[model samples]
Target: MSKPKENIFDFKLFKRLFEYIKPYKLVFYSLIVLVILLAAFSAATPYLTKYAIDNSIITREEKDFLFYIVMMLGILVVSTVFQLLFIYYATWLGQNLVVDVRIKLFNHLLRFKMKYYDNSSVGVLITRAVTDMERIADIFGQGLFMIVRDLLTMAVVFGVMIYLNLKLSLIVFAMLPLLLYATRLFQKYMKKAFEEVRTEVSNLNSFVQERLTGMKILQLFTRENIEYDNFKAINERHKKGWLKTVWYNSIFFPIAELSASITIGLVAWYGGLNVVLNEGGVSQGDLVAFIMFIPMLFRPLRQIADKFNTLQMGMVAATRVFKVIDTTSQIDDHGTYIAENFEGAISFDKVYFNYVEDETVLKGISFDVEAGETIAIVGATGAGKSTIINLLSRFYEIKSGMITVDGIDIKDVTLASLRTQIAVVLQDVFLFADTIMNNITLNHPEITEAQVYQAAKDIGIHDFIMSLPNGYQYNVKERGVMLSSGQRQLISFLRAYVTNPSILVLDEATSSVDSYSEQLIQNATDKITKGRTSIVIAHRLATIQKADQIIVMDAGEIVEKGTHDELLKKENGYYKNLYEVQFLKEHVA
Candidate 1:
């Protein structure tokens, strides 16, 4: 398949990149000056040799020859000192600039709404932050410095050659246009190859992440061989892309080397013939200087070509990183309203929502829950039960209606303020790799140890946690993988209680736990819901039998809603049928 075409390396992006080095301008400029000095010293080496050959050795002036040798040694020492200083400062500048770029990019990414994360791959985003930034740093620290030094050396040497022997210099200059043409063609082919290599790398990273995360599922299904084959395919593709890039680079270098060799041979032939024919003939010293300058002239052309390749790779990586930084958050926080204390009353008025356009998930849903009321939402999968809680939490905006808390439309209150008043315990609980205490007190860091222990005790997990090797200080591995599903759910419940929010949302929070854990959660719920408005979405009908109101949803609307007794009184009601089916299954079991 043909790959997609991207624009060539953008000079505008390079300009913006340099702006990042502005804070270290003093160091950068010092490095530039050192580079020029080093190049000048290197260019002057040929002339020094010429002076020794013509004025010292030819005239048998041994003292003059020794003086010239000592001077050359001193220049070498100065060049070495300056070169070390430039390298130190340039490396320091590159490290600091990369640090700043990562910090800025990460801060911007964190400010983006949840939807942005939902749509982007975790692996690709991580690569942009780490691998891509490293490439840019290499370009600035090493590639950029080499280009500057080599170009300056080339220019000074060419100028000196023209002054000493114009005819030989012109003969050498005739090859310049050919070198330019060759560089342009090589760059065109090499850039495309490098871009493909980057894309393939990203894909490989994504595939690895997916497999690692889903290893449990793959093992459970005994699909290890299938996954291995899939991985091998992607790995081979990445290898092929890199091989193509290397191939292009390999071909370009030898061509440049051959061109340099041809130029050197022509200079020797012409300068030697001029001396023999005595037609403004070159001196032996002048001929040697011309030959020395030939290599210096062509060397920069090779360095420039290589630097262009590094630049292209860095540019491709920067484009990906900037794309993430430039993404516009779909959810806007424009509310001017602020609520110091909420009454916990929630109302949905003709609310409609859709994840996919033109396909409604919640249609004209209307409900009112007074402060301190416990409302149970019951529905089959895809019946809009979870959608209601998602909208209430402002995780998603309602499509065409108003959801209000404390009599003010939710859209008028800042998202932070609105979420602060709510606590959610979801089915798939997410726990960071940290101590148990940190996860429980995530929202309320100031909660005392006594309060944390009390919250864990209330949820009936206190004894289990205390029995662990480190008690509340016990480490939870990634996503709480160290704990069982029931244990994780209990910790999630404790986290919600520690927050002490005014409104509580439980979405299948107790479904994954064991019977013992469920009882503990029920007890905690009773204590926590004493004065707070609570909404529960559960598959188990018995769990919600005591709710103040039960909302039975079907498709995208509330088909039936009332107290359990009232719904059971109506023979054809959805709740009545669902309850009967569950009750029969329990009895049979």
Candidate 2:
């Protein structure tokens, strides 16, 4: 188990966490009031018992004894009510505060650029959003409020003990330094232990999430045993992390109990001697109350140490969550362009881009497409074909170039308006684990059920969808695995069709589907591309033969451009060569 690199207990970190709690200040203030009342009642209990012993029982005063006993019972009842109120309200405050923080963090996550997700782990982020948030809630619900209550209890107990007998109180004070030292050690080591536990849990989450997502591959390749062994190792690390906290507890608790026992013993011995000597008039009642106060004082010290660990864990979690919320690397959607009636004329001027610095994927590439034009971009793998679509959609920022729609700089347009204007059907269709209808509409109220059904009908996928047990209401399950690849593609087409965007992008959309789905897609494509500006990134030479213009790219630069028939006339042209390899080879075989 490793320690965190950041400062373990930062006041600045805690101050930031409290901002989330500020909204519920009323509840917290009320909880604090209850805490103080509870402490006060507790302090009075020992005194009431002391008075009963001395002035009532020992003196054979029945009336005074009954009154004192009744008073103690009444105080206990009131204190319990306060404790219940504090617990419920404190928990409520914690839940509300965490809910707000989680919502804010998730909203912030949505704004981050695609590249951030590409480089980050989903499992780790989930842990931060879900598990880490819970840890922070523990600080409010169980940790900080408890700490405050304990400290106040200890303070009240100390004061009451001193008032009862100053000599016994002084003797009790002798053990304070040692207890404090033990608590300090417990907190320091436990902080590191909890940090390690969180880290290992995150690692385990990542490992399990990734493996389960790809479980099919593991079984298919007969690597289940290997993966299980790996999982066991990671799980062991998680277990070891928690065990370290247990180890710290084992060492600290016994020591704490021993110190507490010694305190009580010393108070008894010293108070007994004082009573025998009649020093400071230490009566049996006073000695009993002071002895009771010993446990009350020591209990808080132990509890405070435990609560501090929770506070520490929460601070660590908050730091992680803040790290995500604090991220500034997001797509700059500062563009002022609002497309009321967009003429989808797209142009790329001397564009250059690279996912990594000094490694250009698209180099000074320039192109033009008129509104309502069907331009097919064809290239071998890594020829920057899909990169063109990615840049046009503004998924990633271009290094140095101007991509424009209707001659308005894309960077000058708001992302929502720009994205709403374009519908992209990716090669690998992703369906949420939701009803088919919801997947198509994506909960867009404007696109109703009638519109979706009509769109599916128009795409010739209506009958196929209706054949399913639940029709369009069926849940696709994770990644749409329940449906065939072809069915998923049809759903995607329906999704795009209902959007009715000015620009439609189909990037290898029909490549992975079967012949039947391809034919259906071709028919849907013809209808969808009738007037919309469509960018078709395809490797299937047959699908794009009717394209108004075909741009052939090689090594990040356009190698050829013309109609299918015209490009075929050039004997050694890149497009001609590709068409022969893809189409002619199949016919020859």
By TM-score, the best candidate is 2
Instruction: Please give the range of 10 consecutive residues that has the lowest summed lDDT in model 1.
Output: 580-589
- Report lDDT (CA) for all predictions: 0.84, 0.89
The parts of candidate 2 lying over 4 Å away from their true place are 1-8, 276-280, 587-589
Error of 1 at 85 (Å): 2.7
lDDT of 2 by residue, 1-589 (tens): 9965655468787788788878888887898899898888878888998899999888999999999988989888888888899999988998999999999999999888777898888899999999999998988898889999999999899888877778788888999999899888888888889889889988998898999999989999999999989999999999999999889989988998999899899988988888888876789899889888888999999999988888888877888889999989788888887876678899999999998889999989998999999999999899999898888778899999899999999999898888888999999999999999999999998999999989988989999999998999888899999899999998998899899999999999998899899999999999999988999998766667889999989889988888989999998888877877786875475
Assess every candidate by TM-score: 0.94, 0.97
lDDT of 1 by residue, 328-408 (tens): 764667899876568889999999998878999999999999999999999889999988988987777778999999899
In model 1, how many backbone clashes occur? 0
Instruction: Give the lDDT of residue 151 in candidate 2.
Output: 93
